[model samples]
Target: MFDIARQHLKTPRDLLRFAMSRFTEAGLFFGHGTDNAWDEAAYLIAHTLHLPIDRFDALLDARLLPSELNDALDILERRVSERVPAAYLTREAWLAGHDFYIDERVIVPRSFIAELLPDGLSPWIEHPELVHRALDLCTGSGCLAILLADAYPDAEVDAVDLSTDALDVATLNIERYGLEQRVTPIESDLWAGVAGNRYDLIVSNPPYVDAESVAALPDEYLKEPELALGSGEDGLDATRAILEQATHFLNPFGVLVVEIGHNRDVLEALYPALTFTWLDTSGGDGFVFLLTREDLVTGGL
Candidate 1:
């Protein structure tokens, strides 16, 4: 079947169509860098050709040589057989429209928190201008830290992660964006190595996937490091630690923002007294919550 399909795949558009069909037939997951088969197929086709993604309309009709067609088909076949994310296969991912170098060393950057960084945490932050220091916990690929640096140019951002491999990828991205002066990659388990530092804003997209959920995730997700995905039985082990210790690293008026994914109900039940101000993004509820230092001290443990 693939042989017949490959024979007809002579142009970029033809290859895209063939890939989308194969992806759907293989029941592939698309939540890493794209959400659907069409976009994912386009990404694979365009990136394989070394053409810009946005130029799809202009380049769709371009014919592919025999060798190029074989190479593209091979990648598409491996994507279906391996179940690895297209971003890992392509060695790139984008968050908030910003490009970053990615690999198996880190999880593909897909945090919804990226959508909320442009506004500078407004309404939740009374004085956005006063945000001089910010921290990104479990800063995979350093995408969030880079976004924070871009959003708040004057602020110094510290990105921490336990996995040295993931930190290496983050360092590459930090350097790629020319943000070494503003963003520093620190090797630490949460906040252990960065003690005594206070920040006006603390953000995290920690490993909140529970053990059961982690085990049940698609093969594409399994390609990422399990240390960056699972937290404990309830998936709140890392988040619980962050909530307990975040206040110590926060200034008087500091605020904490975190993305717990679908674990919001568990988190809310765990701490019913604390009012978690969930933020809304383009992708609906977002499952991200904001809390002030006062809220953490007075309401949260």
Candidate 2:
């Protein structure tokens, strides 16, 4: 197939156009068709052949060794064949302005918590005593955990994920940022693994995608862990459990902030009297809210 590059592949962009046309012609769903196909194909090519992006762009359809060229084409064509995500194949994804490793092990970090951190959490953390301890529950790629640690340099941040494979991904991210001393990656099922840990600031972007939604998601999502996406039919299976136990695990003036996502309306309608400060931020509208211990004990406090 190395000889296929010389099969008049045309320009770099044209190659992607050709790839997209072929995938579509085959009636394959290579994601939402949002990203460029040949570009993605190029990424796979560059990765396999160990070529820089610029070099690949400048030398489109350039001759390659039989082995290297076959490898590149195989990777590109496999994505169309498997319907798996390019991110899963590449093991990299960007969130909150940084790239993190990803795979079939954990759910891709798409949590809107990125919008809640940095300058956003400041207003919600008004309590003078709420600065000491913090937790990043259900931390996937350690994305939230790293951000939390970076945000609260004065505080210790605990990052927890249920799957050991997921935790390993988180560990790679932590060490990649030289955060070995700050971010603590703990393997736990929500709060089950924490023995004597209560936090002044507890944030979780747990699995809230409902069963129907899970099944309805695009094929690429199936590459992630099912346990990390859907939490029963109503989707709050984990959230409900988290709400019931989170208060006891919070400091007196502490806060429990969970990202309920687009299902915010359902949660609000179900539990009306709770005091949840729905955060508005730069990234987008949020399902994340700050609920203090008092707020949790009292309605949604």
Candidate 3:
């Protein structure tokens, strides 16, 4: 198998095609930063060669030197043999066109909430300019926190996570973006460490995968930290904690947005009376909901 892969893999495009074929045959999952084998292969090949991923079309036919080809083959072999997500293998992940360093220490940033940040949480947030404070709970890579900062330039953002290693990665990214003054990384289990601190907008892409779902996830997902995926039986343990305390931390008229993924049904059943305004994204139903302080306090549907 290895001999066959190496024989036909001559140019960067050839290697990418071979990698994509192997990836498809292995039934690899592509939730982290990519949605298909072709894109993932292109990302690995482009980044490995230190070429621009966006400019891959022009460089696809470019042949790699012997040493570079060897490096590419080694990475592809590990990707298949180890069943690791391409992001972990490459040590980088992109969200909203911005790159962030990643490793086993943190979950690869792939939050759907990122797609909604540009509109300034419109309709839900009547006055975007009034959003002075924001919070990002379970901020695995601080991607959302950084996006929050970019979306709300005047807002001071606080990103919280329980994993020290994840926080380290987040800290690096915060500094990389030169957002040290605007974004603060906090090591906390949910909102524990940041209690009493309130925010006008609180966003989270928490651990919402149920035990069974976690167990059934592809090997690629298993490569990520379990703490960043599994929550509880209903996949709402962390989410419940956030909802229970989010009200207290949200200022008047403040809104809380969360991504529950496929666990939306369970969340609705758990809190049937509360009306959840599911947000729409380009990819369709984002499974993210918005709730205002008044909605939480008044139990208004």
Instruction: Write the residue-wise lDDT of candidate 1 on 5-75 in tens digits.
Output: 66787888898888888899999998997889999988888888888889887988888998888888888
Ranking according to lDDT, highest score first: 1, 3, 2
Can you give the lDDT of residue 19 in candidate 1?
87
Native-referenced Cα lDDT, model 1:
0.89
Q: Model 2 lDDT vs. the true structure?
A: 0.75
Error of 2 at 276 (Å): 2.2
lDDT of 2 by residue, 114-214 (tens): 76665677766854344677889889889888877777777778899888988998999999999888788998888898878888888898988887888
Q: What is the lDDT of residue 99 in candidate 3?
A: 88
* lDDT tens readout by residue for model 3, 65-138: 87888888888888888988888888888898888988999998988799888583788776657889999999
TM per candidate comes to 0.96, 0.82, 0.95
Top TM-score: which candidate number?
1
Question: lDDT per prediction?
Answer: 0.89, 0.75, 0.87
lDDT top scorer: 1
